[model samples]
Target chain A: MQPVAPSLRRKPTVMSLLARFAWLPLCFVLVGCHIDMYDQPKYRPNRPSDFFEDGRSMRPPVENTVAMGSFEADSALFTGRLNGELAVDLPMELTADLLERGQTRYEAFCAPCHGLAGDGNGVIAYRGPLQVPTLHNDRLRTVAIGYYFDVITNGINRMYSYAHRIPPEDRWAVAAYVRALQLSQNVDADTLTAEERALLGGP
Target chain B: MSAQIFSRNANAILLVSIAAIVLLIVGIISALIGLYLSPWYTGVGDAIEQPVPFSHKHHVDQLMIDCRYCHSTVERVAHAGIPSTDTCMSCHSQIWTNSPLLQPVRDSYQTGEPVLWNRVYDLPDFVYFNHSVHVAKGIGCASCHGRIDQQHLTAKAQPLYMGWCLGCHRAPEEHIRPRDEVFNMAYEPQMMPIADRLALVQEYQIPVDGRLTHCYTCHR
Candidate 1:
């Protein structure tokens, strides 16, 4: 190893130690604020609130305030009601395409609780106390299509409302499909088309 | 001073100290890198310890039960909701009535207390994922969850990072299926004759442009 030059070999003086350690205090003061983006002042889901009277973070929508494009000009179509009673007929026209769309939506949404055949033996109903009522039954079969729409829009007994998930058009479609399922199961053989009748061995 | 600083045995000591410091820094960096890439941190293919061992393979593959049967809120809720104890007892009540494995489920049914299932595909708090939107958009469960029907114990099939999400958001056609076959696990895509597949994408009303690729689509 090379020997240090006489000039470089300085004595360890108190002043030198102070000069060498001058950056220590500056280091303490220079730690800039590191606010983690995730840990910032924010409200999480279902967090309680001091601002609301109810103390819930989720606030109820202002009463009677209509959302843009969601204004229900036709009360019958949105609510299935005409003068505080369930309407007899659907506000919208029923078509083959509408029935098909209804079938798809119904299968996805309703088939879990209401069986694919409307027998109320859906995969979920088989579980425990969550008994789903059958659409093919007399009480449901005689009810207006609008009644089904109403019940779907605003749930009944143990069944939660599906209003948010099922659009109005789809809700009407589902009601139509439920009617179709009811008819298909309860239909007389004489009412079938000749080809359909023959297919069912009813010729 | 004691024989002057850096004078006797100073060079050897200085070299050793410098080497030790370098080793320590390297060790720390490597450890961090290793930890970040490890399965413990990334949770890739790691089957979490759930309260009860529910096999998707048995229900989905063997019995051929639809996914929506148990995940009742997949098409409506933000998260694909877990099955209630009642849903399990629906089948297990008749079949596995007395099995020791299903004791917790039976107990949960007897008592209203929920089964605290540990989530496997956990994302950071920042990622706001909506299941209904994706399912409605015709994105199949397999797209993100991988072949869940084959998994005995459910695991995080993908990294589920922002980059992984963007890969599909950038081009969803490859993953898009006919809406009819969305629940069909056996269905596979054939984009080889590219025109037909591209047409199918349009037919399904799939949003393919910058609409889903935006950061706000998922983050906010």
Candidate 2:
């Protein structure tokens, strides 16, 4: 073999060694670039769709169509009316559990405008500077139980329909709670026993 | 020794180069870890811009509306449903009827077009999280979302890292609360005793057989 000069032998200097591993850092940096699995090419719930004209990933049910097993056979459960007039009685048997459910539902959906006491003193009513009708009034107190359900299902006056927020059964629950509230506020003092009066903290 | 081919500084350069390489590797790794955890990368506190600048503080805290009133399906389904325009109008039709801030909502209502909301807690597609199951098992809204009732604009509270999730899944008793308090934003996990939480884990039938930590639990 011909003798080669040390200069031409290509000594592995610090710069050469550094250059050898320079591509290593690039590997780490590039790892973050491929996030295909992170965000897949499929539509998630409410994800905007470019293909749809409205850009909604969730398509609305066809007009005048109801989902399977969702349709209520009892018209009164849905409309809060029977034979075209407001049903005076609850469609389902009223139980303590139902009343409790009603109380919670009312506090959540109705109490925001229809005060906790149903006197229309809810926080929203106060802030709305709008006259939300008191549920304790003569007409409201005398109205059929289904009347409250009807009003909630199809809003009266300034009230928008809460059908979207509160389901039909929940609307009935709120109605039942409204009745309970009316009864609570309208108790005749003379009818109470001394023990009951003592419990009520009233003379 | 006769030729003196190498310079004295060569050893110094070699030592410094070795130290520099070690430091470079350490520095790069540290930078990557730091960026991964940062709010900029993780979007932990980023408040996404919505067409309507709805203040959760105003609606949830000040107004005292229930979280379920708006996110209606949180207890019933996987997705904590965004309220429809009508849910907004249920109050807006009576209140804030003319605010310029609610113009997009009004337009959406009138046009029958959905208001495009920017998602805040966008988890990766591979992971399957069910809001109903967690809610039923006694995880509060604030557990993962933080004190959202206090946030003027909703922002991400958790980084939603797999390790953060496994931290709880591996031992859920550390975070579980009463089923009733699941909606209470102020309720803390520590408020309930460890014994009670363990009891709830049993009562709620939360699997403690390492099934929660299994690969298919979330990924599938």
Q: lDDT values of the candidates? A: 0.76, 0.89
- lDDT by residue (tens digit), candidate 2, B52-140: 89999998889999888788878778999999998898788878888999999999999999999988988999999999999999988
Model 2, which residues run further than 4 Å from truth? A1-33, A73-75, A189-200, B1-24
Candidate 1 residues lying further than 4 Å off, grouped into runs, are A1-35, A44-74, A124-134, A137-139, A153-169, A188-203, B1-38, B47-133, B148-155, B190-195, B202-220
Among the numbered candidates, top lDDT falls to 2
- Writing each residue's lDDT as its tens digit, candidate 1 over A1-203 gives 46789999988899999999999988877785454564544555444567866565556478877777664756888889888888888788889998998897788678866889989987667754566777877888888778988887887776656665677888899999988999889988877888898787643
**TM-score of chain B taken alone, candidate 1:** 0.79
TM (chain A), candidate 1: 0.66
lDDT tens per residue, model 2, A7-55: 7898799999999999999989988898799899998898999989999
Alpha-carbon deviation at B146 in model 1, angstroms: 2.6
